[model samples]
Target: MEVGEMEMRMSTLSGEQGKEKETQSDEDRGYDENMSDSPRESVDSTNETPSKKTQLEDGSHSLSVIKKAVVVLTRLPEYKVSTLRPPTPQQFYSEDESHSSSDSDMQWEPEDNSSDSDFSVTDSKQKTGKPTQNDTKKTPAPQTMSEPAPIIISSAFAYCANEITKVRPDLPEEEVKVGMMVLARKRHMRWQQGKIVEIITRKDGRLKYKVNFVEKGKSLVSGHHIAFDNTPKLEQLYVGARVVVKCQDDKFQSAILAELPTRKNRLRFLVFLDNHVPVYVGLPLLHLVCRPLENSLDDIRDSPHKCFMSRYLRDWPYPHLTQYSAGQSLNAELNGVQQRCEVQEVDSSLIHVVFQDNQHKEWIHRGSIRLEHMTRFLELKEIEDYLDDSD
Candidate 1:
């Protein structure tokens, strides 16, 4: 019995050992499968993590590049960037385009309230701001143009009219018609014969006449300077008188009146010079030298008239005849024509003169020259035209 019991115990022990070995093999197989699966899972997890990290880095780099592009666009000028940019809301749009945009905005309003509110505020601010800026730019231009234009125009007209009046105070204001002959005082204060060309009436109702002066150019003259006739009227005063008459050469010569003036002869007197040269003269040309008694005409005719004239001529108050000097400027008679001359040499009764008009030189009697005071007066009057502006 003991031997059988020992065998059985030994078999049971062996069986227990075999079962334990089987359990170990199963556990080992499971562990080996787990190890293989774990390796594949770990590989997949590592790949996925690295891929996610790379994707995030690529997204961040693209964002940085896009930001740099926006910065570069912002730094460019408006005109250069205009082609690259879309139309802005504040820019001017056609009526149809604005209506369409408004409809689209209305359609999108409920879906995008915050964006719509911001856009509306910006549009309102832009609309209000633009007009004020335009007003500031436009207001000054009209004011600058309108304020001083009339004042300057009126002042200029007044100044010109005043200057004309001051220069020709001797002129008589007369009603004149176009195509009429009149004596007009020139700007140089010289009387000239002119025919009225046109009559200009200003907006202020003032009249200015255009004159075509004889031998001079045309000029605009005021009414004050126009005279239909400027000749002095001759009357029956002192016939048969000895007189000094300004001849055609502008020299004063002694003459004895032979006949009184008559309307048929245009108020001219018949006179005989000391050389017995007969001529007709206007009243203005004659200065009374001496009016002899009515009964002395026969005695004066019988006596030598040349000798009587020479006696009076010697006592004539002509101071400039003795005051001749070299380089003196005077008006003289050359070949019976009045001319401007400069004295080259002087003698007691004769002077060497160089004509200003033709540079011709000649010796002439001192009696042929005009008075010095008349030339000086004319020069001073011309100078007064410029000096009046200072006052």
Candidate 2:
């Protein structure tokens, strides 16, 4: 029992020693803190004791005000603050900065008469370090294309008065002028060259022209069947006139003008051949005689209608192709990409289509969409039944 009491007394002594050591360490920390504050206190005493400092010393400063000052807090390691110092005296009057003052930093003093005092703060972009719009380079204006020269002919020129014009299929009336020359196409005959002497417009905008065909005589016809005469550049393209036409490989070959340019085709000519049978060629394969001499023979054939059908369909856009009507389903180009569309309307300049993707209607130009090139692979009644089946 005596040995157990001695062991308890030893434990009590060790506990007392630990308590003494902790108290000694706390006193030492207080002493070190006082030592660190000594220099600051001396400096504060040397300077004028400001109202803020005196309020802090008295512990009368509010928590919000103390938090905002943050002079001691900024010196902490958490903020990584090294310097909170003001600019040095030498930095304000540096030799290099004083000698080379930039326009951006130019300041006017009361002693300076060179600069005005009414400085603007609105355009101080340099001070704020923001970009200015004036620094960007301006884009140059686009160059315009030159206008086409006017098509003029002397009044003495006889054939220039009534030139041919093509009747646009989209419009009800042919927009033909009184003096414009148009090709008067008959049922199975060669397209007779005619000049519009007078145009009589009906109430519904249908044009009836008194066409004076130089050979077939004067006849009043609707402008629907007439086409503009854009024949090959020839001096005088008569049906039986002997002409030296430009052939393949830039060689001039002898030929006769069979027919002038139609809407479907250009000028067609009967080219003479030495060995093979004479074949009719168009303007691209043959140019009209630029200069013909006195001995120009008048070439004519009894079988002129034999090869006229073959030559006419050579450059036809809808050859073996089906014509598309309204409510017809077809794939067509929308913008630039081809998509499925239903034909809503067809006009000379534009074709209205309803796109399947967006169910939106858009007008496509006649030049872009090939509505004429559809071939009839199946029966027309079968196609109608197929469309019904799809529905």
Candidate 3:
């Protein structure tokens, strides 16, 4: 019975010692029971190391709070950013401006973007339960954009490359018309690219063609714009064509096209006075014959001073000249009666004719001789020969 009494006393002493240790722990925590309602900072014990002398050998004391610690949040990458702001619920189809404009005018509360889970709004704050003062850092917005490649068109159509080959035949027939722009060869002025639109006939046997030039977002220009020209064209000056003869004054009368400068060569061409008579003149010297139009005024022929002739042929300085050969027989205007004559020599300015009836030699001016309208041009020749001709 005495041994049993001693065991009970030992049990009571052990219970009292456990109560004293718990009281000492509560005092060391520095948390009062009444102050439990106030905010309490959480301590991070992750980086704590065991001390050399283990005070927690019995596991009765608490560790001191860490002085410094870093907090990081692992969040999903926002690789697909639809907009700069937080994503909210949006309807795929929207009303017209009438209804949409009125909706924008009304006062509305800010939307709770988090409630809309359709679009996964990845936020760092959501990834981490709540940001503490130690790790309250911001993340950079994502870089996103979708755009198409640029397609720039300077012009709709460029000049025809065939001018050198199809038009000149002197150049290769390779595709060079692309990107090339056709401009007026007129001097002292710049010309835009022109597009041939139509062709109209004149009182004469010449057919007038129309050309158009469209500026960048400007006005429209037609063949009748007065700026358009028919000369230096691609057709009448082609390999072979018949024409009437006339006289013109030019400084290149002596210098050949092959010897002249590049600028002057462009203004030169070959003209046949007759089958045997060949002459070279500046391009401006020759006039392409005009075809009679359906509404042509034939009455203007009788009266040389008519308005149409005056307006069109105002620049015609030389009178029509006729072609003659050395042996051909013809009539002369020396006497009132018709006299039979024999051709002696043919010159550009003068023609020598001898009267067969009287045996009298006379030199007649080119303007005095009457000739037909048949004028011939060189059919074919090596472009190199034409360009390199010295005589």
Lowest lDDT sum, 10 consecutive residues, model 2, at: 149-158
Leading candidate by lDDT: 1
* Regions of candidate 3 where Cα sits further than 4 Å from its true position: 1-231, 234-246, 249-284, 287-329, 333-337, 346-391
Better of 1 and 3 by TM-score: 1
- How far residue 47's Cα lies from its native spot in candidate 2, in Å, is 99
- TM-score of structure candidate 2: 0.21
Report the lDDT of model 3 for residue 207.
44
List model 3 lDDT by residue over 171-270, tens digit each. 3222212222323212121233344455556687544444444453222221212221234444334322222333443111111111111231243454
Best by TM-score: 2
lDDT of 1 at 40: 25
Off by over 4 Å in 2: 1-175, 188-190, 231-377, 380-391
Task: In model 3, state the lDDT of residue 377.
Answer: 8
State in Å the error of residue 336, model 2: 43
Candidate 2, residues 1-391, lDDT tens digits: the string is 9779857866775676577658756755764565532222112222221111111222453312221111121113422232434567686764433343222321111112122221111222224232233421121122441221111111111132122211111223225678877665443223456788997879998667787886777777754345555444443444433334444444334444433444222334444421112344665554333223232231223243223222222312211212345786766654446677787986432357798999978654332213312211112223545776999
Q: Each model's number of backbone clashes?
A: 0, 10, 9
How accurate locally, in lDDT, is each candidate? 0.45, 0.40, 0.34
